[model samples]
Target chain A: MRLVISFIAGLVFSAGLVVSGMANPAKVVNFLDFSGSWDPSLAFVMIGAIAVASIGFRLVGENSKPFSAPRFDLPNRKDIDRPLISGAIFFGVGWGLSGYCPGPALVSLVLSSQAMLSLFPMMLLGMWIAKKTA
Target chain B: METLFTPWHSLFGGILIGSAAVLMLWGCGQILGVSGLLSRLLPPWSSSQDIKVRVAFVAGVIALPLLAMVSGQVSSIPPVNGNPLYLGLAGLVMGYGTVRGNGCTSGHGVCGISRLSQRSIVATLVFMATAAVTVYIARHLLGWI
Candidate 1:
């Protein structure tokens, strides 16, 4: 049942990416391209997501035991550690260069695009390195 | 299409994603963190772990879009013209960042930041900053579009 729900949800999420023009690397690249033919569509998506999530989150917090779990799995650590900073830098640099964030990249995988095939392996390698170093 | 984005459309889409995340959590006690789900692939995996939840979480991620398609929220897939090499490089960097940061954009940027998490704020900042720099270097320094 959970798997079924997740599968359906993934389809929705990926479809959203496609509809919102996020799945398109060109569109994403255009958004990143501030100087030339800049596209601000992604900003709208961000704004939209923030607005909805913000309100919904408040509602969810009102009740204790958000789930069967005893408590929320909130991050306990709160330090300006090296891994933290370095990770941010890496993420930003990568986003700027490719405009393909994790969400969109994963969704793009289903398409079997030549780019997705090549990019997927590199992403795996990066993850492997991060685990080792961090 | 109009040059500027429609505010309501953005709002609706955001609401959908955010609400979906909340619903999943409330209903199933799951956090929509992609990295968390992927981490399950690690060794010594225990069956005690909520395999159903993990599978559902991933399934939800993939299914949401197809639902949108059936409802006509999504029209069709668009064209991808970016260089494969650059995309691959970016993917590598992101995967590494996911581990180093301990979360992905959705996890840190959305869930963590929403809780007024200092780490998440820094993570989000780093995400934005690096992304900006990467674009600058790629477009200006490398001249590779």
Candidate 2:
């Protein structure tokens, strides 16, 4: 079923995050620190992920619909706008500050991490604010 | 402390993530984006179907990691900025920024670039640059996170 597949996908995705070292905030922050003792591990994560994903997109291009769904929900927006740039900058700053992006932060929840425990609620609040403003 | 660059694990992990994206696309006919999926769980969302996907996906995300930890496969304590206040600030900024930009690392950085979307490429560059600058300021200039 579709639900089973989603769960499996989630499991695989989380495993990747863990194995890639993206789940470690300290490691991520070190990767972001270009001027410092830079760890280029994170770059490989993107490189590896994109390389595989590109093939997936190619396969999808040949198909009209997904296997389990009626239609594919790929983003059609192409324009580079103000909000995009500004939002990205903010996101970047946040990423640099704590090295805890949403995905990894969520994974860290099982650890009962003090930082994520605080970050998660605030993140939801931020999302709520964004929704309200938009 | 000296930080080690782990190419093998990083690359392998990335491949797994990509595989998941591929499966999601092929099986679910949807982009496998963490923040995007998380956003759907919020208010004013579309329908129950959306809820099911998010719930099932997130449950798996959490469940596996939890199992992994029990097996001693996952354990990471943030070396810097363990302070809740600082993390909370970062979280708020990230949450808003990701929504405003319409994606994050998984959504735009990986999936978008994989599809070779111009918007995603630019957004990824901008975020990567800004993140580098932010780290420079916090670590080198300000001497703090």
Candidate 3:
């Protein structure tokens, strides 16, 4: 039962990436350009996700807890300290450079583009370094 | 329609993804985090029970679009190419990120933050920031543009 659900979720998530235009490197890069054609598609994607998640959150909260695990897994910190700022900066920088955030990037993989080819390796390297340092 | 990627459509898409995440989390008590299932491709990292859930999760994700296509909800796919290197790289980054941050954007950004998790907030911020920088360097500074 759970297996069926997971596969469906992944399919929906991946398909969303495709439908939202997040999987398009050109569109993604254009969004980051900010001065070129300035694609705001990613913003739409963000907004769409936030809206759905917000409503879904309320519904879920009202209903029984869904997963076998805890309802919510809260993080441990609250400060707007160095880690927070640095991480944000890093993430922004990466988005600007590669146009491949984690979600869309995975979706892009389904397409197999040159940009993804060049960018994904370094992205992994960055993640690796971060893990090691932490 | 202003094409699909317009603000309205994007917002609608995000809503769908978020709603899916929320529904899955609430109904199944799972986080709807993609990284967990993707990581299951590895033998040591995955458990027997985890495999079942992972399969279902991934299948569901795929099915939604196919169903939509069948029902004519969406007209066309985003696009596709035959570039294995690119696919491999994307996979690698996603896999590594999952390991490093203990979650991906879906895990931390959507699910964790929705739950008011401090760690998820931090992790989500990092994921976004890193992605931003990566784009800047590749397209603007690095001439991959």
Which ranges of candidate 3 are over 4 A from the true structure? Answer: A62-64, A67-98, A101-110, A113-134, B1-5, B46-49, B63-94
Cα DockQ of the candidate 3 complex: 0.33
B89-140 per-residue lDDT for model 1 (tens digits): 7788877787678877667876676666789888888887667666666776
* lDDT for each residue of candidate 3 in A15-34, tens digit (9 for 90 to 100): 66766777565676676555
**What is every candidate's C-alpha DockQ against the true complex, given to 2 decimals?**
0.50, 0.80, 0.33
Candidate 3 C-alpha lDDT tens digits along B64-93: 555665687654423222245644454444
Give TM-scores of chain A for all candidates.
0.83, 0.95, 0.81
Residue A104's lDDT in candidate 1: 70
Report the C-alpha lDDT of model 2 over A57-105, residue by residue, as the tens digit.
Answer: 8987798888877788789999999989998998898888988777887
Candidate 2 chain A, poorest ten consecutive residues by summed lDDT: A108-117
Model 2 lDDT per residue over B1-145, tens place: 3478899999999999999899888888778888788877888777544578778888888887899888997675663777788888989998888888888999899999999899999999999899999989998898775
Q: If the candidates were sorted by their DockQ against the true structure, best first, what order would they fall in? A: 2, 1, 3
Instruction: Score chain A of model 3 by TM-score against the reference chain A.
Output: 0.81
TM-score of chain B of each: 0.77, 0.93, 0.76
